[model samples]
Target: MSHKRSFVRRTAAVVAAGAAAFVLAACGGDGNGDGSAGHGGHNATASPSASASASQGQHNAADVAFAKGMIPHHRQAVEMAGLAPGRAQSAEVKKLAADIKKAQDPEIRTLSGWLTSWGEEVPAEGAMDHSVHGMGGMMTDEEMTELENASGKAFDTAFMELMIKHHEGAVEMAKTEQADGAHGPATKLAGEIITSQSAEIERMNELLGKD
Candidate 1:
């Protein structure tokens, strides 16, 4: 009876030690000393995806439309600007065209990038006919063709007038964005466009010697 009791006591001691060792090993591996890794890891992994989802979701339809529409509009402006270097006669006209190209080219890329990041469709060059876009102040196809064919002082005059109208259209779009857009960067760009192009519009009018 005494021998059997000794064997039982030793076996129970070994079992307890083994259990304690297992618990310690698990705690060391988990690093938290708590049985929380499973839940904690799942939450941590899900956080970034949730954040990205929320960020992408913040933009509204107006924001998407603005980015899509502005790209082609800015492209047409750049195309018009490219004509001025060789065809325009006035120094001021040439400089203004260069400035427009320099400023708006990067903005086109910026808008395109934003649209792409948002999973929205980006408008390519010639994506829409300006005349049919129903956008304010966009030049007609005939108007663009006429400007392209013009040269010397005629080119300068046509470029300025067309650009003024184009900038006006951009301002209108930007104003809409400012009022209705939900994306922060897009709204900020809209405000900058309003300020910059409004000034440019005034300058172009001054160049044309018009009120």
Candidate 2:
């Protein structure tokens, strides 16, 4: 009788221990469906995501200024190029204008998108004052009007001269961006602008017989 009582007591204690362990195991799940611990639970950290990391990449005031200033600058160039189709004397001039429009339009959209992603205002969307944003190769209203009114060889001469000036201004702005801008894409675009626009300037010079 004594032996049986002792065996019964040991069995009862073992069953109690088993029940406690089962309860602990059941409560240990993190509820994230992965059966992990402390994840998606109270101990999860407030860490930033990969996308947030990408967006936090280097950028500064010069980068911002480059984008803001260039959008309207490019817009004006596109407008000028649009005028060249009907007014230009030479087929070469017309093609040059078309090329400028083709290249700069997409670039304008790219710059605007970057600014929007950065939580900055896109220029020429009624956000920026035109006077302030005319920092790069932008023409004033009077100069634009002069181009608008001219035709034939006069239009060709004026377009070449004004476009040279415009290209020079863009080169200057791009050099500043290379020196001061922090964002990689902005700096890259600046370098490209310098290369392509400098070449265009040379081409225009050739067209003007200045080369």
Name the best candidate (by lDDT): 1
Predicted candidate 2 versus true structure: per-residue lDDT over 2-98, tens digit per residue = 9999999999989999998887776664243453334443234423454455555567789888888887778778888999999998898999999
> Which regions in candidate 2 have their CA more than 4 angstroms from the true location?
1-56, 125-130
Worst 10 residues of 2 by lDDT: 37-46
Q: Rate the local accuracy (lDDT) of all candidates.
A: 0.85, 0.82
Residue 39 of model 2 has an lDDT of: 45
lDDT of 1 by residue, 17-94 (tens): 999999888878777633354457766767888887786667888999898888888888888899888899988888
